[model samples]
Target chain A: MAMIDSTRRSFVTRIGGGAGAMALLTVVPHPASAETIDLPERESAILEAAFGSSVLTPGKISLDMPILAETGLSVPVTFKVDSPMTEADHVTRIMGFAPGNPEPVLADYQIGPRAGLAEVSTRIRLARTGFVYAAAKLSDGTLWGTKFSIIVTLGACVEDIFDLDWQRDAERRAMRAEARAAAAAE
Target chain B: MATIRISIPETAAKDEIVEIRTLISHPMDNGYNVDARGQRIPRHILHTFIVTYNGVEVFHANLHPAQSTNPYMVFHTVAVETGTLEFTWLDDDGSVFSDTRTITVQ
Candidate 1:
């Protein structure tokens, strides 16, 4: 897969830790470099109830998928479904769901007129081989869904990038407090 | 009243891509926290937040108390225009608190 390396490499975001939810990934992501992609039938049924079943066809949506991968913990994914984005055609929300994972709905993002680009990239984990689905909710109250897969090569999992426990945290906080005190009198 | 602080870095590009972060102060209660009576606190949450640009709603949410205490939300939206970012946070009781500040877009 010539496009595989360039694709997976772009998914990393420098958006550092901010919430407790970040640590919940321990049970969710699989090994590093090896990934298996799949999707459940119930997921499509849910969207069919919302968007009337025509949403999964890759009609106007511009999406990139990886044919092969080595990691399941932090895989890069981006999705952009075409829309006029006018009040009549704007996308009200874009939701991602990996049903096999601990959290079914990964994240729901709201988009508005000021949102310049239709493109979105983020790091996600695949527990095993499963389908990852993307859904777009339009302003008109309609739903759409698309499915994609990433083939795994290495099939080995890796440790999480962070544990976020109080032990490691206490050490970091102590150093920061020391620095703040020094700066206060300067 | 509990309130969340929102901050956007100065180095962030105007029209590139940026993650908007918001953290609201709330006991969240989760209906899981019990009172002296051993009764669930009845799930008090600041549900339904609206992010606006120039008086237009850009993003909104219907949040549940199950969301962690002092809920922190971050999402991506590309900036196409320069204007004040207005956030209206609503509570379970229909109470509304709003804040607005102009983004110094270069």
Candidate 2:
């Protein structure tokens, strides 16, 4: 009985190895041939939450930012949307997101016909080297989006200072000041 | 009160597109950093900024911690009439800092 069991186990192992090799052979040829732009899962989820069920058309948005940043503490960004800025047709909102940051949602701008141009410039903090996305919601309920890739030499948002007690330090300074005042009075 | 700087044309033509720039001084602590003793620093940042032209809301922004220190913004608006433009910045501590500028549209 033991000998028959060992034989069956070996047979199953051989079949499994053969199937795995066949699967690898089939998948190794295609190295992502399609040129479709893919967004990270978190970024896609954010877009879905902002504009539910609306198709994100990748056009009409021009995102301008630096390709390389010396520091992640501040990265300048500018985005513009091609719109007439009329009462009937205009951009209603623009949103910026930094997926590499601790909190992805950077800022959201609300505008209307009063906004003569759908352009904005601001500074944002990035945690690391990654893609920054900008989306615009027009009056017609259509969503337009774009993205820019940036590389950061020094990242931000990581706690740098440690082993320093702010409260105790302040207290000690205050005590020293009081002692000085007492000596001056005497 | 925080220091604020606003730059806009003193006068503009009717229906002209005018660029408005604003800068405010704030720490914008993102709460992710730690103190000298390794204690987490509480987050304090300017959360909202709003601009009203002649008492009508023109542009507003919801800011997050990702905004850099001393937030600066530049945007555009149509000069509909001669009126005051009020810019307000709201802080995380429920404090509001505001400034107003007058523009003449001929």
* Candidate 1, A5-108: lDDT as tens digits: 32333332113222222211111222334332234666556555545652443333333445444565445555565676655577766666665443354445
lDDT of 2 by residue, A123-162 (tens): 8888888887788899999887766777888877754322
Report iRMS (Å) of candidate 2: 10.6
Least accurate 10 contiguous residues by lDDT in model 2 chain A? A22-31
lDDT of each: 0.53, 0.78
> Model 2, chain A: how large is the TM-score?
0.63
Name the candidate that leads on lDDT.
2
What's the C-alpha lDDT at position A17 in model 1?
A: 28
DockQ per candidate, 2 decimals: 0.12, 0.35
Off by over 4 Å in 2: A1-38, A160-186
Q: Give the TM-score of candidate 2.
A: 0.77
Residue B42 alpha-carbon offset, candidate 2, angstroms: 0.9
